[model samples]
Target: MTNYLQLSNITKTYGHFTALDDVSLSVDKGEFVTFLGPSGSGKTTTLMIIAGFEKASGGKVEVGGRSISELAPHERNIGIVFQNYALFPHKTAVENVYFPLQMRGVSRVQGLRQAEDMLSLVGLKGFGHRHPKELSGGQQQRVALARALVFEPSLLLLDEPLGALDKNLREQMQIEIKRIQRSLGVTTIFVTHDQSEAMSMSDRIVVFEKGRIEQVAAPLDIYHRPQTSFVAAFIGESNLIPAIITSGAGKTAENPTLGAFQYAGDDALADGQKVTLLIRPEHIKLSRSPVEGRKNARMIVETIVNYGDNALVIGRAGDIPMRVRVLGADVVIIKEGEECCISWAPDAVFVITK
Candidate 1:
């Protein structure tokens, strides 16, 4: 795919501190790419640079094969939605949506009609007359979205726009936003610390850490084949065991405390190289006895966290902490403070060389 948006060797620094270090990425037109990382991980700083809110200390920002490096925020023709919605409280929903078009020289009669259509598209058809205070959180979010899309901006930037909504509303908006983006076929860059949101909404996820790009891949690829230990740990619950590669060709490694493990993939790993092995919790099975034809280990159950549909069985395999995810029905077979056998397949083990 052609790069609709490109950041070429972008870097940001404040005094002696570096906020972004040589970050580069290419985003396809009409694709939804999420910038995901923890707080202070440079994800937001990168987004700010792309939106022209934060000037990069180095590199270039390009859109549609042209340099937008020097464009001011408004001149960039980018629509931004903030965590707080940033809606005009005194203005009604339609008025809020109309403001952007008005700034673009659209007439009151035409802009208001276009704003109503946008609001209706966002599922707030009859609520356009209501002020921000009169509308629900989700409604206000719809208005924000409508306003952003009203002018047909070149790109859409959402900086944790769902952060202020409740869980249910946030989930609802995720679906709504994806639908709208797809319908409009607009290029989008979403910034959020929420991994589940990234996984659910993004076509690709770009992981940021310490002002550098860690891994940029599809959601499942990032989860199952993490390029680094940090990606494995940060994206999901994992049992990361530090081990020495015993046989690179055989795909085996040995942890000092937890013993030897057989993995599925071959890497550029030398024999006796120290590495970390990642096994997702959901890939492990717990039972009274070892399952046939599987890698088994003994774990003393430490804690059981039940979440109705599924439960997390936390325990220790020797000195290594292990977590097993079991179905709610299967969790009945085990309890807290009990000794159990945990087993996983060789393919379940992912080796993170970094």
Candidate 2:
């Protein structure tokens, strides 16, 4: 089967600086993929190139085996939703959604009917008559989304469309967007720096760093089996301890300060090879005394951040900083400037050689 979208060794350069370096990937039909990275990490650059807004200096972009490398932005038949809902002030919500079809010579009556159907799909059934200025921020966003999908484009690209909304609304739209995308089965590439958003929405996430693809995997796989140190640290809160493989065949590593950590995995590494150990904050249990049946360490509690239902305890386990997540109710048992026992099972440990 042909790939829905294929980016082959895409490269972008501006004079002397390189924005993207030999980046290549493929997206399956109806697949929801997220491009996740920090600022200047080339996620949006790749999105723009795929949309035909920023031409790649090299390589080809194909949709269903047809190269669109030389096509204009509008010629690509890709729907894009921007951070700012780019709606015309004069156009009503239905008109805004109708504009795409209108550009294709859709009649006002037929286009308005199709536009209203899309608006209803996005939960703006009765508000299609209002202009962009009259609609709420969230409503305007819905209009923008409806417009993007009205044309039945081959691919949909979302460029941080939820960035302008508040926390709750942003989260609500995440679910709504996912629902609509699944209903339409449109191939999508969503770009955002928010790891939680990526974690919650994407079928697979493409991690980008310094203009390169770091790793591409399912959300849980990316979190638990990160391919690089950058991915382990970027995806979520982690305690990364530098260690050396004591006995590679034994699946054990020795940290200078945290002591020995027995890992659970079959990795091929030479004995005494240097590696990084990743233990998530939630995996560590804090206690007043050493926990039984696990690797234990004494940490001096340096800080406690409470979040109603859960809390993060940041401290030092020997010279290495450690973070532990605990129930908010249990946080009352520990105080900063005091020593607490932190423990984790062997399976909680992940080894990153790179």
Candidate 3:
């Protein structure tokens, strides 16, 4: 795919503090890309740079083979939706959606009709007459999305657009956003620290930490084959065990507390190489006794967090803290403060050398 948006060596700073460091990435046309990381990781900074809201210390921002780095935010033909929907309280839903078109010199008669059509497209059909206060959070979100797309922008930037809603509404909007994005096929950049949001919505995920890009890959690849320990740990709940390669040819590693482990990878690992082994919580099995044909460890159950469908068993095997995810029904077999058996297959372990 051709690169529709290009950020080359983008850097940002504030006095002595560096916010973004030589960050570069290419986005394909119509791809829904997510910039995911914790606060101050430069994901929002990069989005602002692309939108021409923030000036990069040193870099080039290009869109559709043209440089837009020097353009004003309004001149960049990009639509931005922030954490707050930022709808006008005095205006009706359709009026809010039509504001951008009105600013572009479209006639009210024409713009309002177009806005109504766009609202219908976003599942807000007859709600055009209602003000922001009259609409539900999800409806307001849809109104915001309609406004962003009403102008048919070259790019759409969403900065944690669903951060305000409660859990159920947030999930509902996730599906709606993905549906709308797919229908419009607009090249989009979504910024959020929520892992599940990034995993479910993006065509590709850009992971950031400490103002640097950690890994850029599909959501599953980023989870299963992370190139760094930070990516492995940040993307999900993981048990990261420090180990040294005992047999590179045999795909074996030795951890001081966890003993020997057989990891799954084909990297040209050298004997005595230090690495971190990533084992996700759901990959482990918890039972009363050690299971046959799997690596087992005895863990002292410390805490149990139940979430209806599943339960998180947090405990320690020796000094190594571990977590196991089991079905809610199965979690009843173990109690806190009791010794239980946890086992995993060899292929469940991923080796992260970085």
Candidate 4:
């Protein structure tokens, strides 16, 4: 697939502080790509550089195989939607949405008609007359989205677009934004600190850390088979246990205390080499009785937390804490301070370096 937008060796530095470090990535035509990371991780800075708000100190920005590194922000023909909406309080929704078209010398009547259609597409039909303060947070965001799309730019950039809404509203807007992007078939780059939001909305997620790209993959691939310890820990809840490779049979590792489990691959790992095993909470199982003919580890139940649909059981194997996720409706509930064994398939344990 051809990429619609590409950032090649892009770097941004503010004196001694580097906001983005030699970041290189490409967004396929009509594909939704999200830059995900914690605060100060360079996700937003990368988006700003792509939008031409921040100039790259190195490398080039390309769109449709054309170099856009020297293009001005408006000349880049990129539509940007910000968290604050950035609407004119006194202007009505229609006027706000038409602002971009007006700047391009579009007639008032044609601009208003186009803005009206954009609002209707975003489910804001008949809301064009409302002022910024007259609408809710979600409605204002919809207006901002309409404004961004009215120009029909080659790329759409969203910077924490749902960060201003409540949790429920944010989720709803995520679906709305995804549907709109799919229907419009516009190449989009979304920036957010919320992992769940990015996973739910993007065709692919690019995980960033400390001004560098950590890993970029589909949501499921990144969640289930993380390439780095940071990617594993940042994307979801995981139980990391320190262990050493004692054996490699059936492509598995033998933990001195956790027993033997299948390894991901037949890599040449030296015996007694230290490694960290990553296991998602849901991958673990707890039982009171040991099953015969099975190699597994035993742990003492330390705590149990019931959260509506599921229960989080915290257990201790030796001195390490392990968490198990189980159905809330299960008949067997392990009490705190009780003894239980936690076992998992070898394939479920992901080995990572420190």
What TM-score do all the candidates reach, one by one? 0.98, 0.99, 0.98, 0.95
- Best of the candidates, TM-score: 2
lDDT score, candidate 3, position 83: 84
lDDT of 1 by residue, 67-86 (tens): 99899999999999998998
CA displacement after TM-score superposition, residue 70 of candidate 1 (Å)? 0.8
**Candidate 4 segments exceeding 4 Å error:** 265-273, 292-295
Evaluated at residue 229, the lDDT of candidate 2 is 99
**How many steric overlaps does candidate 3 have?**
0
On TM-score, the stronger of 3 and 4 is 3
Candidate 1 residue pairs in backbone clash: none
Better of 2 and 4 by TM-score: 2
Which parts of model 1 are misplaced by more than 4 Å? none
160-244: candidate 2 lDDT, tens digit per residue: 9999999999999999999999999999999999999999999999999998999999999999999899999999999999999
Model 4, 105-184: lDDT tens digits are 99999999999999999999999999999999999999999999999999999999999899999999999999999999
196 Cα displacement, candidate 1 (Å): 0.8
lDDT agreement with native, every candidate = 0.93, 0.94, 0.95, 0.88
